[model samples]
Target: MQHRHACERRETGGDRWTEAEREAVARDHRDAARRHRHRGGDEDRGGFRHKTFVRRLRKCFEDHGRFAGADLTRKQALRDFFEEILLRRRLSDHHSFTLLGDLRDAPAKRFPGELTRRARALTPHLLTTDAAAGRASSARPCVVLVEADPASSRVATSAVATAGGEVAAAFSSQKAAASVPGTVLAIVDVPDRGALDAVDRLVAAGLMVVATSGAGSVALAVEAMRRGAVDFVLKPYTPEALARRLAPRFAEVGQHVANASEADRAKADFGAFVGSSPAMLALYDEIARIAPSRAPVFVTGESGAGKELCAEAIHARSGRAGKPFVALNCGAIPRELMESEVFGHVRGAFTGATEDRAGAVEAAQGGTLFLDEIGEMELSLQAKLLRVLQTGEFRRVGEAHARTADIRIVCATHRDPQVEVAAGRFRQDLFYRLHVLPIRLPPLRERGADVETLANEFLKRFASEEGRAFRRFSPAAMERMRAHDWPGNVRELQNVVRRAVVLGEGEEITPEMLPAEVAAGTQRLLLERIDEAEVEPFWMTERRVIERAVAVFGGNTARAAAALEISPSTIYRKRERWAELGT
Candidate 1:
């Protein structure tokens, strides 16, 4: 009976102490409780009552040496009894299980079957719950985890589903390859080269694969990359870390698929101008307002500020969308042939006019005429264009009769039309006619919080077009992008994002992927100086010119002095003075 009692005590975690030791601990606990109660100083009545109850329980344990003999062999009996008492005392609380205290030195328990069963029961419920919650369309995309081990797969599926991704299906490697669509990006725990071979097959079949090995072998990861795996996340990763790595890729894939499926729907839709910034929203509203009108529209902005895109948007939304929307570059047309190109000519109109032909205006009759670089149009041609706008009629060179065109006109220029008009380079009347609906596009730098949205949109586009698995921009890359002034504007931003997407090998696009000028924020500073120059006095132009030269030379005093045709000492002195003035 004593032996049985000792065994019971051992099972119940009481064997670590002798009866005397137990009594000593109980006395110590009671004393501690009494001290706590006294520390309350009678003001904390509830604390005193709590401490008194604990002291009473300790005293009872010391006196009895044990609780009621209720299966003392059960390791959980004491815990259950304590939990019950805690509930009864209104102290019920859930705490994290301390593995060191709960299972230290105990024989490791294997309940794989129970874990597997629980995961299976939980996974579908989790997926169904997420679907009901309508989380599939949220910004964060979901990943479907697959493993050969049924238990591991179940756990992975449950975790991913709970994270708001639809687990399309989970199976063994062979089954996953056969059953899973090429669109489903697979995350596999590669056990060996054979597992890698399965990934290879999936890749060959045009599916995106991300393989992970808990062992963290570079060989497997490199091999996977070489075999066209989108990313390789090593284990043992927490659910959060894995999700972070996989979500963007999944989102990219889903976005591409959606875009591809709806190509027809998006044909007339403006290219992915993803932004909700106030400026962007306003621009969109402006596009909608003036698109259907037949009035002559003029778009003005910096070089890469997407003036052409605005023109396209106007054309796409206009009543003549189904008709040809012709574009001609006045600056690109040779000066000698600019008149013939604009007005069209008979066979004898000019040396190059081989046959009777139509001008851009005639070609775009009943549609839209897009004139880029209108400010660059020669002075003589500007007079003819003014006549065309005034009368809506033009006679082809050497042709007797005037041909009238019924077309909506859109013109874009990077130069300041008012300056040109004041300088007598452009006709003020023509400027007014073309400026019937003027749209001034803001530079990429001024479009707050739109950089990220535009970057993401470009990433999706280039990834699809290039058949790559590009994902999201890294936080550092995003910061660098936001810091840039984007002198070239949206067109420049689009190119940068496209380049990053194509060149980026990791799941995140880094600052290194950006152009050196943009990554270093040099362009931003230059743009700021330009802005300052606009407000500076005419006499300050010389200083501004020198300052720009210094910046171009990377603040090298000797180089800046050489560029400015001044001495190095002079450059240094000016810099010092500018510093003192806090310019």
Candidate 2:
């Protein structure tokens, strides 16, 4: 009768609690709170209440803890229950249950009906979450505990489970974490500096990490954050506190992994470039195809659009990878010294030529010579550069004999080569000479979602270098960055991130931390809204934009296609369709 009454007080019901029963329950609540407060002693900031933890453990076992046919005792069954259900740890070699495959590979009926129903209910949300961010969010996201110490791992696993998240355990290798299919958020134990490499590997694999360290290791915690841990907690943290810290990030990464489109999770890196957008992938393909040939590659793009990096990638991919790659900025050099800069000069060739110096051509022998801002080279120097490209031989200044040249030339300019040729500032012969393989880099605004990818990468690198606490950008800042027209391209974005890391405090980089120009860019759209009566079909707007582009280039669909960051074939196809529709 006493046990029944106690159970009644514990369960939720209006059974008319006696004064004695009421007092007993109140005392229990007070004791639970006190234990929760001091469970980890002086070092622990917050902790799980032992009574609550044990009660939940018992309840989970009662529901799903079945040891069919095996002669396991009750104590052994309880241990397996804690490991398999609450901790979500894999028991691949267990006699009865083996979670040895992908999360989807597990049979639906393996668990009871309620758990299966819960997973199915989470499916739609998983599909819709953070698709643009390139996260593989179709499966249920798991909190992976990456700790070498078995004790710490168990503690973290329980805490994550207590906070109502699926949990998994991985040790020193972090290979097990990778094997667990789904979106993963890691809780890495940083006992010392030796574990930083594990943090790096997990981050590079695109998992979000929260570093946990014991007290008096603030420096290591900061280093972990610098190494791309999203957040950190001190040792002996409470399940409640861990949940509170993880909630925002969980929402940001889109609740948990769910089924997503292939393109959404495509690899976003090629060579030194970090983007998976169609334009960048196409550019990468083009570069690969052109790198084998000995043709002079001409690159055009807005300034700071990674034109030099493009040149380096070309050099790296070509057969000349072992040779030196010499870069000369034609615009940065004076006209008087431009000739000597391109070709070697003999001692006493001209003023300030006291010693024999090798120019870019000599330095780039058996390799590639990158001439940046070739449009800025004077007409006189253009003739000389053309001579080298044509004859593959050139004399140094004040030299009688011509030297044989063995170098591939890769030139880049911010200005359009055709426009420069037409203006007579650049030689038509030289323009054709270097335009054998033209690559036009798309501006940042046109590369969808790459902006966010780049921002996160820059944040990680800069945070590490500057030892800042910033781990990720706030949602508002990410939106602002995406909306801003990065006129200066990648360089501008790098500078903004560096500034934020050096000056901004806190874990998240907010919009206020960004430059005034970038933050204000959100409101810079030409048309903020269209009235309901004035609204028209999207095709009409697209047609107008396309037609305007074509008209601006004087009916040259190829040039207009380049300007629009689309293919000429696409323009032709769209035009034919529009004609048939007769809009």
Top-TM-score candidate index = 2
Q: Write the per-residue lDDT of candidate 1 for residues 1-583, one digit (tens) a residue.
A: 3423553565465524344434444454446656866776452222335435534543433333243222322213333333344443344232211211121112224222322222222232222222222323244343434575534654455345444454544445554443243235667778666677777767776667778777678897888888888888876665567667767776778777775545434333556455556676678778989998889999998898788888888988889988878889988989987777777889976676779988898998889889999988988788888888888988888899999988888999999999999999898988988899999988888887878878888888888898887778878788778888788888888899888877778677887888997788845645666764368675367678887888898888689888778898886787688788887
Q: Give the clash count for each candidate.
A: 0, 7
Q: Which one wins on lDDT?
A: 2
lDDT of 1: 0.66
Instruction: Give the per-residue Cα lDDT of candidate 2 at 272.
Output: 73
Q: lDDT tens string, model 2, 1-583?
A: 3524554443433333344543443344445546755766332112344334334333342333322112223223334433433232121233111111112123545444343332222121121222211233234356656665545654554455444455533546333234334646877777788877878878887889888887548799889999999998887775567777777766666533321332344333244787777788788878888888999999999999999988998898899999999999999998888888888799998888899988899899999999999999989878888999999998898899999899999999999889989988999988888999999999998898889989999999999999888889989998889889999999999999999999889999999999999998788543445467888889889999999999999999999999999999998999899999886
In angstroms, the error of model 2 at 190 is 36
For model 1, the superposed segments whose C-alpha errors exceed 4 Å read: 1-272, 467-469, 501-504, 522-583
Can you give the lDDT of residue 360 in candidate 1? 90
TM-score of each: 0.46, 0.50
lDDT of each: 0.66, 0.70
Candidate 1 vs. true structure, TM-score: 0.46
